[model samples]
Target chain A: MSTRIHRRRHAKNIAAQVLASAATLLALAFLVWILWETISRGLQAIGISLFTKITAYADQGGLANAIVGSAIIDAMAIALSAPIGVMAGAYLAEYARSTRLGATIRFLNDILLSAPSIVLGLFVYVIVVLPMTAVTNGTTTFSALAGSIALALIGLPVIVRTTDEMLQLVPSTLREAALSLGIPQWKLTVQVLMRAAGSGILTGVLLALARLSGETAPLLFTAFGNNYMAFGPLEKMASLPAAIYQYTNDPNPALHAIAWAGALLIALFVLALSLLARTVFARGKTSHD
Target chain B: MSVASVTLDSNRGRDRTDARNDALFRWALRFCALLVLAALLGAALSTLWGGREVLFGDGWRFLTSAQWNPVENRYGAWAPIYGTLVTSLIAIVIAVPLSFGIALFLTEIAPAWLRAPIGTGIELLAAIPSIIYGMWGLFVFVPFMAAHVDPLLDASLGRLPWIGTLFQGPPLGLGLLTAGIVLAVMIVPFISSVMREVFQTVPVRLKESAYALGSTTWEVAWDIVLPYTRQAVIGGIFLGLGRALGETMAVTFVLGNAYGLTASLLMPGTSISSSIANEFNEAAGLHRSALIALGFLLFVVTFIVLLIARWMLRSLQRKAGKA
Candidate 1:
């Protein structure tokens, strides 16, 4: 290449580098701006009462019911999803690793992993909520159970993907050693393989839980948001995201303040879970290596 | 002789028990695996079933018409469909380039010591809930756009001869453009991470050869790295596009939820998801069915998009394995 062409190419490369750096800075700036806004506005609105009282119409209550409801719903969702996801993943990794069925399931699971949560919510509404409502003769069927089911669907694929990948990482020699001992395939998988992948699976579950807690779309119609404290799986429930969504929509200033507080709590909890999951993942990687 | 026979009998019994338990456990695992497939089928079928009333009743008009009047029990998906497509288009146009930049910065430009932390930071941005974006967009970014970006567009792009009409509108802050920007922000981390992963897959030797030929980093990236991972890169972009199409709460807050399509990007409009979310709560009878139909439409569109993405990525993976 001629010297002039080389210099022009260098100039173009320099320009590209500048643009790339600026893009990174812009991305980080957005993150900081969001965090700053959420913390500043949220801290002002957060008070003891915000945690102690149930939401009141127009202004006088905190997010106690919502916090409790969200906890119940999320716990139930993880409980329902984690076991099935792990089992499905185990099957894929051990029994069906090279099978056509395994590849199909894995592909479907990946698609589900990115499938829209709101569509899942609509599915639950049609399959679970509407049927229950019909059976109960128009009594509201929007409940914590419905919400949990929706969220579980969202979490299920994440757990499956992680567990499958983690299990695949296990040394084949471990399987051979166990099999040489005359261990049953089931026993080897459950006792040894699962133990090896336990921390990795936990990381997946924690990440799923983090994702579930921040979900607003699936819970919009399923749990449907309650103002009062209620724990029944069959009754409408309030969750942090649902409450935040509702409050944000209302024209009331006080409601908006409470919404900010809720957003702060959720953002903090999600960030913490993500951090914890990363730590667990990093530790697991080191141990495995 | 008696003791030996007793021990043999005990061992036989244990083996039988083990066999039985193994068979049962294997069955259970298979059942769980099948359940994942079942869930996907159930979601598709159930939504289709729920939306059948409108699907059959309104026939093709449901998709082609823009009329959405709950009071008259008349509904069509035209406006929301148009909005979803337009906003997602805007999101991809803005996000793809920015993501490419971020990915390039992370994979090539950033110092080795700084790479991991910055990469993790960007990934963490993806972990932030979409709802938080919605809240921030509604409360903060919308106002900023109204004050700054909209006016800039109005003065420059809005004055253009042909496409000016698309930019002309009242700058109330919440509209298709605002929602698109928010969606772009939401998907940048996802696309960038995917890009970074695939970009890293470019053979070091190939890049080195390019550099030895006096090619610049940009030249190497544009000519070598990009073409090598072209399939996966497009797959990643499609993945982000699918997400933008289905995103609900963020767009719901900023989309302004208008009923009809308009010429200007500044006008408020609804998406398939935001419409379902905003109306599913109290909509009754045919109105509910209409929203369900919209959901079904979104489900099918996203499924096709995601399937293509997965296929592209999988093909790339297979080729990589062979290489």
Candidate 2:
């Protein structure tokens, strides 16, 4: 009787392990399906015309305008965010350390980091876009500038948190040695600590960029997505993700195909950036402990 | 003596300049840190400012009413609010068990060779853009569900009393159920990753002692690991809830963007993020303010959910530290 009970218990253990593993494999199968569907269906719409023309109401053209617009907005967003994010991160890591102020900033930054992109879009629409439109005499405009600011807000906390975490990884021993050599706190952070944490910070910034690039909701209210190719940051500009959203909702099969291609392009870019971040971090060999 | 004094003066002058530069640099970083504070303040203030018209102009009926006519300037958010809650609740139901299982597999059962790569593959799903998920859900998953899954559910569970109404609708390929499932798929990675981290915090000694006492893997996991991480597991579920609540594009594509609320999950619905994303443009005056107000409400809800999750994790950490 004891031996039979032991066998039944052993069988149950094996069954449980198999069940858990099966669950994981099932999850993976879904991931595989999504990738497969994206690549197979997405590739059909990719061509030179996709790179050469502006989108239209009737869905005859490509995502060329959106491509340019996305690049412009991304450039502006990165430029606006990088310096400030890095500086804030430096303060959290080196200057404030663990003060009450630091703790408050950390807490707020955490909230900001995960705050909905749509809410950020609403924020910018109220503060920047609406006021600017009113100022421009009801031009019905949604400038790329407004979009960039919204994207910058989305990326800010990500970069700050990454910078702070990366800087925290720099050893206290290093700080002590540099201080003993008469290095000033600010100088030590900028010249010594920043250099040590460079790769990790770069990884964080790149991932944040990838994240912002795919954001559609925030740009919907801010960029407002122009049909025509825009010239500068002052004008409303189309972006790939917004284009995808618009086209996907349209009844035209051609537009749906275009949306698929756009989705693939955005996904590829995001995945590449994520992989690059991992590679850079691995190569840095920095102190994770 | 004169040469030594001159050298000392030069050294002191250089030190003074260094101090000045240092002060400037620290101030600059501090200023940048304050920019984030300013932005956070700006966001909240703008929400309050933008929704000012809705709050004061429309009065309290905006919360209770269901009519949202952009043409007529009559706005109510009850449908979107209801939809967001119900869909997120469904998502939690679908995601929590799967995430826990995935976390367990990764931590306790996955092979040494498979662990890192599998872990990475799962994390990569989180990197997949929400828009892509939206597209895929619209084109592939929804149709697949409408054809195969929904009818099967109807046949199996729908024939029963009381449960039939939930499964009675013609699977139109996009609705609350589809949106909830897509959200569940989207958030599984994030929740599972959190779960994996929390599970890793469970000491090896306890698990090993259980094994030495001839505890089956299931017995050890259930009796030891589950009790240890119960708070954190709930926290992970809430974290997933927060993501589902705020998620825009994915739900927008699959939720059918219906204007009204309904009893059945099979029927179409609208979420706060989706409603705003769908109608914010050309939403003149009161309509626009209403959308912004909707966003504020979403922000408040998500903030509360996140705080609860954070509290749970903090308590778990304190217990872990003490133990």
Candidate 3:
């Protein structure tokens, strides 16, 4: 009986090992396939003209305007979210501590962190875009500002959560030393605590930007994708993800090629940002924490 | 006043200014923190207010009806809701076991040199954006599936009872199954990473004792590590489920966005997020409100899933404390 039990367990172990290895291989293979597909198709479609002009007409268009538009939108979003996130994080660490309101806000923010980006876009559309159209007598104008608002909403929770966690990691002894110097509360926070936690907070900001830049759903309802080189915030703006979305939806092969190129650009940009953020924060952790 | 008295007055005045500055700054920080909460409430309130037109205009029929005609101003959410649930369920089913296997492989079996690099590479998967996943799903994955896997399923069991119908159809490749598979791929990193973390938290002593009892690697993983982290593992699954439910771009590309109910996973269908994404732009007046209402519904579903997940996590912490 003992021998039989031992043999059965041995077989089970081998089978389990096979299953585990297969899963890992599948996962790794899928990753390679995606990167391979994006690069091969996207690289071929890239051209000097692709970055120098607005999408001229269908198969003739470049991604210049879309790239610029994404930059403008994400910059605006970071500008809006970072200050608010940083200050709120300070309050959570410095003042509120574990107060009722702080805990509640933290909980809700955590929910919003995982909330669908499209829903936030709808919220912004209902609040900003739709109302703006109604006030303007229905011209159907999709603006960079509206896209920024949507992106900001999507990024807000990420920044707040990161700021809060990073601020907590700043040691309490640092705060006491700053206070001993008779520094004002704001100065203590800005000069001492923030300096100590700077890299972690910056990591959070970069990660948020990385997250907001790839968002196509929210931009669909807000930016709505301009086909020309529009420069105004109130003007409809083209974005790389939106461009990719539209191009792939088109039945033309040339359009599909452009979409692939746009996908490659967005993927590389986001990947680089995240890797940079990770390395920066990982260095901070090893050097300090 | 004497010179000493004059200097004392100035010093006192400076102290007062500093104290006031501290108060003002403290209050400002507090207000900023309040803004985060305000934004959360504002989103929920505005979504509710925007959907007031739909909520009152259509009543419960919005949830019950299957017909969606924006020109005629009519809508029903049953089909999209069903699609969302089914796709998420498919994702969880495909992802859970695979995530467990990968987690076990990383924690219990992998060689030391390969571990860190493999773990880091797997996490790089999260850095790829959802829209890119959508693009890949549309351009590469769809064609691959339509060419190979769909035909195999059709030739084999496309004639059975319940599940056979799921494999029925011309294998267009843009359907529920494709969306589910894509979502499965997207969520693997999340669930597997989380599972690996949880599995690593199992007590070293417990694992060592199990090994000493002549238990094989698989037995230790299945009988020892599995039971120890079961609740935490479930919580990780729910986290992935929450993501799958609200996933928009990737699912939108592959889900085909057709509005009908069938057991056929091969059939084209629409999810709530995809419905909102596809129609929210051109949808005017009532159609617009209905789409916002859909967004609201998606929010509620994901919110509930997250809350349950949090509850599970809290319980798991308690379980760990007792252990």
Candidate 4:
């Protein structure tokens, strides 16, 4: 009877192993399948015109305007978010380490971290868009400025959390060593601690940028996609993800191809950013050690 | 003597300036931190204020009713809410076991040389944007489902006596079940990575002792590791649940944007985020408010789920630290 029990258990073990291996294969297969579809379709749509021409009607044109617009919006967003996020992170690490208020803010910030991007869009729509529309008489509610603000909000919590964590990781002994030198608290945090945690903080920023580059839902109502190239932050602007969304919805096969191409661009950009962040972080860790 | 006195005065002035600068810098940092708090409060209050028109107008009926009509200016949250819950439920059911298997494979089964690459591969899956998933789901996956999987399911599961209605729909293939499967794929990386991390936290000594007792690998995983990391495992699952619930783009593509709820999982349905995404652009006045209300609801729901997950994970971390 004991031998029979052992035999059944061994059979179960074998079955579990098979299931696990299959599951891993299945997960990897889906990844390959998705990447393959994007690359093959995207390459077919690639051309010089894609870089030179502005978008036209459903069957024609390229994504020049959208790419440029994406760059502008994303750049402005990083400009706005990086400083504020760094300071907030510094505060959390330096002053509020054991404070109740700091803990509460951390919790709320975390909630904000995973809060739906669409809701942030809505929040901006109501807070910035509707008010601006009302003040301007509906001619300029949806603008690149509003979109950047939403993206900045999305990026903020990420930077703050990473900065706080990275600063914490900078061995308390370093803080004591700096403090013992009679350096002011703010200067010590800015000079010594920030320098030590610089790469990790930069990694956070790059990851945030990668995340923002692909965001579509928040931009839908805020940036509100345009066909022509518009440089001013006050005007509705085209972006890669928004353009991809529009073209994907279009019934034209040609437009669908362009959308795939755009998706591939965004995907490659995001992957590269993340890869860069990882290498920077690994190098930082090694040098520190 | 006169030059030395002037230099002393200058040094004192510099010290005073430094002190003032230090105070200013400290306040600036505090202001930035407060700004983070203010952003959250602002979002919540503004969403509440925007949706007040619908929330107060519909009262509690909004929660219970599924009817949505723009022509008559009537709307309810029932259908979208139901779709959101059901799709997330389907995602959890499909993802949890697969995630467990993947986690087990990563932590225990794989050879040492293969681990890092496979782990990175899984993490890369999480890095891909949701919009790409949506695009793929609409053009590639939906067709694949309609042509192949739907008919297979209908032929087999639809023939069952009791749970057959779900499989009995026309093979349109853009429905709750399809969206759920896509969501499952989107969340697998998150769940599996968390699971793998928590599993690794199990002490090598405990695992070695279990092996010494002649326990199978399956027994070690199922009985020992699972029990050891119970809270964290649940926390990981809830984290995935939070992501699935708030997911917008992926579901928006393949969900067919249909209104109303049905018993069949094959019928197309609308989720809250999809509803807001599809209509917020064209909607005006009350219609717009209703969509905002839906966004508000999505926020609150995800917030609660993530809070629970954070609590569980934090508690476990504290216990680990203490040990």
Candidate 5:
């Protein structure tokens, strides 16, 4: 009787295992389906003119201008955010230790980290765009500079948190050795500690860049959409995300196809960034080990 | 004596130069830190100031009034507020159980070889952009819901008194219900992954003890794993809630952006983000201020919720440390 019961129990366990595997496979299949659908639809629109020409009359536009605009805005955001994010991270990790201020900063940082992108856009609109409109002359409008600034704000908390965590992961023994050499605390941080944490910091920056690159909500109010390519930082510029939004709404099927292509490019960009970050961090870990 | 004096003079010069360099570097680092603090402060203060007019001017009336017309100079955010809350609540109700079940399955039941690929697949879902989700929802998911899911729900549940009212609708493809479902899909991966991580923190010894006692896998999970990771699981739920609340583009596309409340989930409604996205460009005068006020309320709601989640997670971390 005991043997029979044991056999029944083993059979039930095996059934459960099979069911679980089936569910996991279903979930993975769903992901692959989405990816395949996106790629197939998106690839149909890619062409030579897609990379070299500006947006033309309604149906025949390429993404050359949008790509340039996105690059410029993202680059500016990174330039503005990196120094501040890294320094704040350094303070949180090295200076504050476990003090009350440190705890407060950490908590606030986490809140900022999770705060919604739409709220950030709203904040910028209320604070920057509306005020500028109220005070300035005629037809005050959104600019690429304003958009980049908002993106920088969105990127800031992620970089700071990542940098802090990575720096903290550096063992205290390294710090002690640097101190024992009679180097100042600041020098130890910049020369020894930061060097050790360099790859992690780079990964964090890359992840931040990946995140902000796809943001559409914040730019809506800050950059507004432009049809023609305007190279000025102060002018309205076309970004891949904003272009996707506009083209998706267009009545033209060709424009809709272009939107798919734009989305594919954006996805590819994010995927590359994440893969780069993973590679760097993996190398860093192996080296440390 | 002459040799000793020469060495001492050189050492003194080296020390002076090092001190100067260190001082400059420290000053620069401190300045940068202050600038970061300033940026945070600026973001907060400007949001507050920009919305201060509406916040202080009509205060309570601003929230209660339902009207939102720009040309006639009347404004209210009740519809948007209601839409945001209802959709998010619906999303959480559906998502929590599904994610929890998936997490349990993955951690306690799945075979070893199946785990890694499944985990990676779920994480990849989190990586997909909101815009792509919006596009997919617009073209594919909404039509599917309208054709199949809505009809089924109406046919089955339309007779029950309370539940019947919820399903009663024109079966339009885009509405609050569709938005809520999309949100559930978007947030599932985040909640499940966090729950999985927390479950792994449960000590191996505890599981081994349960196994030795002949406890079933489900029994071991219910008795040991659930209790061990309860706090973290709650934190993970709140994190998912935060993401759902703030989700914009996908919600914008499917929500239909109507400015009213209705008993039927099939009717169109507007969220804070969707309203802002749909109308911010054309708004002028007090209309802009009112919209900004709506944005302020959203910020406050999300900020408080996120703060609470952070506090919960911190306490959970402390408890884990003690254990």
Candidate 6:
């Protein structure tokens, strides 16, 4: 009687485990389907002309202008954000240990880190783009510079949080040793601490870039969508996300195809960045261990 | 006397070197710290200056009016605000439990061989760009929902009181309910991944102890694991909620951009981000400032949500450490 009861219980447990496993598998399968559908639909529009030619509303145009514009804005954002983010992170980790002000700063930084990208864009639109449009009579309405500034703001908090966390992970003994040798605190941070946390900081920056690259809502107001090619920061330019948005809504089949292609490219870019960060972090861990 | 004087001179030289280094480093650190503060301040100040007109002029009235007309310079943000809140709440309601279930399954039931690949798959979902989600939501998912999901809901619950009101519509599948569903799908991966990570931090010894006591897997998970990681799970949910609330592209694509409060979940609605995205280009003069004001409102709301999330996470961390 006891043996029979145990066997039945064992069977029931196994069945439950299988059911749970199936549920998790189903969740993962949904993700896989989404990816497969995006790629198959998007890959059809990939062609040499897609990369080389500028967008023309009349004859289905390429993403050349959008690609260039995205690159420039991304570059500018990184350049502007890195210095400030790294410095703030260093201060939080090294100087602000257990202080009231440090705690406050950390709290505020966390708030900024998770704040919506759309809000940031709106903030920029209200402050920068709207004012500029008013001053310039809407002729110089949207520019790459304004877009870069908004992206930089979005990038800053992520960089700061990552840098601070990475710096904190570095052993205090290392800092003490450098200080004992009569090395300046600034030099110790830049030369020793920053170098120690280099891979992690880079990972954060890459993640931030990936996050901002796909941002559409923020750019909608500040960058304002462009259909033509323009090179300078002062001129209106297009980006992949904005282009995808524009094309996806259009009734034209050709524009729809381009939108799919743009989606695939953006996904691929983000995936590559994630893989790169993972690889870099894995290598760093092995070396440290 | 000579030896004493030489020793003093050596000590003074070392002290001077230390002082100089400290001074230089302190100056540099201070300068960098100030720059960080400036960046944070700049973001806040710019928004305030740009949004001042709408904020001070209308006060709370801006939030009460439902109409958003850019042509006639009339602006009321109620419609978008309502849509944003309602859709985000719907997403949270769906995503939180689903994520928790997935996390529970992964931590307790899944075989070791399957964990890594499944975990990575979920993380990959999180990494996919928002635009792709928007495109997918626009093309395939919305249509699918319209055809199957909406009809099923309408058929089953169409006669109920509150539930009936929600499901009542033409089944267009491009509205607040659709946006909420998409947001839930988009954020599920993020919340589940975080929850799984936190769940893993529950020591193996704790599970083994429960098992040794002849506890069933479900019992162990509920009595031992769930309590241990409840705070972290809450934090994860809040983080996901933050993303869903601020989500722009996907929601914008499917939300139909109608500005009004509707009792039916299937009806089209506007969100703050969608409103700004759709109309920022065409808006002129005070209409522009009003739009900026809407942005300001969004910023304030997100800022508060994030602050709470951060606080919750920190408290969770402290609790876990104590445990």
Interface RMSD of each: 0.8, 1.4, 1.5, 1.3, 2.9, 3.0
Q: Which candidate tops TM-score?
A: 1
Ten residues in a row with the worst lDDT in model 3 chain B?
B310-319
Best by DockQ: 1
lDDT of 4 by residue, B95-177 (tens): 99999999999999989899899988888888899899999999999999999999888899999988999888889889999
Model 5 residue A135 CA deviation (Å) reads 7.0
lDDT of each: 0.92, 0.87, 0.86, 0.91, 0.81, 0.80
Range of the 10 consecutive residues with the lowest summed lDDT in candidate 4 chain A: A51-60
| Each model's Cα RMSD | 1.2, 2.1, 2.0, 1.6, 2.9, 3.5
Tens digits of per-residue lDDT for model 2 on B27-79? 89999999888887787788878987996787778887889777788888888
**Real contacts retained, model 2:** 0.74
lDDT of 6 by residue, B1-323 (tens): 69999999998897788678767766665576665566556656666676677778877888888877776767778999999999999999988777776887888877789778778887777778877888888888889889998888888787787779888888887888899988988888878887887888888999999999887786677789889888777878888888888888889889999976789898899898788777777776787777777777777777667766777778877766787
Report the C-alpha lDDT of model 5 over A114-230, residue by residue, as the tens digit: 677877887677667767767776356688888888888888888888888999999999999999987877789899999999999988899889889989989988887677777
Residue runs of model 5 more than 4 Å from their true location after superposition: A1-30, A130-140, B1-41
Off by over 4 Å in 6: A1-23, A57-59, A130-140, B1-45, B203-205
Q: Weakest 10 consecutive residues, lDDT, candidate 6 chain A?
A: A15-24
Query: Candidate 3 regions off by >4 Å?
Result: A286-289, B1-8, B314-323
TM-score of each predicted structure versus truth: 0.98, 0.96, 0.96, 0.97, 0.92, 0.91
Error in Å for residue A78 of model 6: 1.1
Chain B TM (all candidates): 0.98, 0.94, 0.93, 0.96, 0.92, 0.88
Give the per-residue Cα lDDT of candidate 5 at A72. Answer: 89
Clash count, one per candidate: 0, 0, 2, 0, 0, 0
Q: Write model 4 residue lDDT over A1-289, tens digit each, in one string.
A: 9999999999999999899988888888889988899989999998887887888654578899999999999999998999999999998988898899889888888878878889999999999999999999988889999999999998999899999999988999998998887677778889999999999999999999998888999999999999998999989999999999888887888999999999999999999999999999999999998
Model 5 chain B worst lDDT run, 10 consecutive residues: B32-41
Model 1 misplacement above 4 A: none
Query: Tens-digit lDDT track for model 3 on A1-289?
Result: 9889888988889999999988987888888999999999999989986898677577887899899989999999899989988888888887877798887777777777778888888878778887888989877567899999889877878888888889898889988998898777888889888888888998999999999999999999888898888778888999989988888888999999988888888988988999899998998888886
DockQ score of each predicted structure, in the order shown: 0.84, 0.73, 0.74, 0.74, 0.48, 0.51
CAPRI-style quality class for the chain A–B interface of candidate 4 = medium
Write one digit per residue (lDDT tens) for candidate 2, span A1-289.
9999999998988988988888788788889999999999889999988888889643678999999999999889989898899999999998887798987787778777767889989989888987887888878568899999999998899899999999998888999999999888787888999899999899889988988998999999888788889977888899999999999988989899888888889988889999898989888864443
Q: What's model 4's overall lDDT? A: 0.91
Model 4 misplacement above 4 A: B1-15
DockQ of 6: 0.51
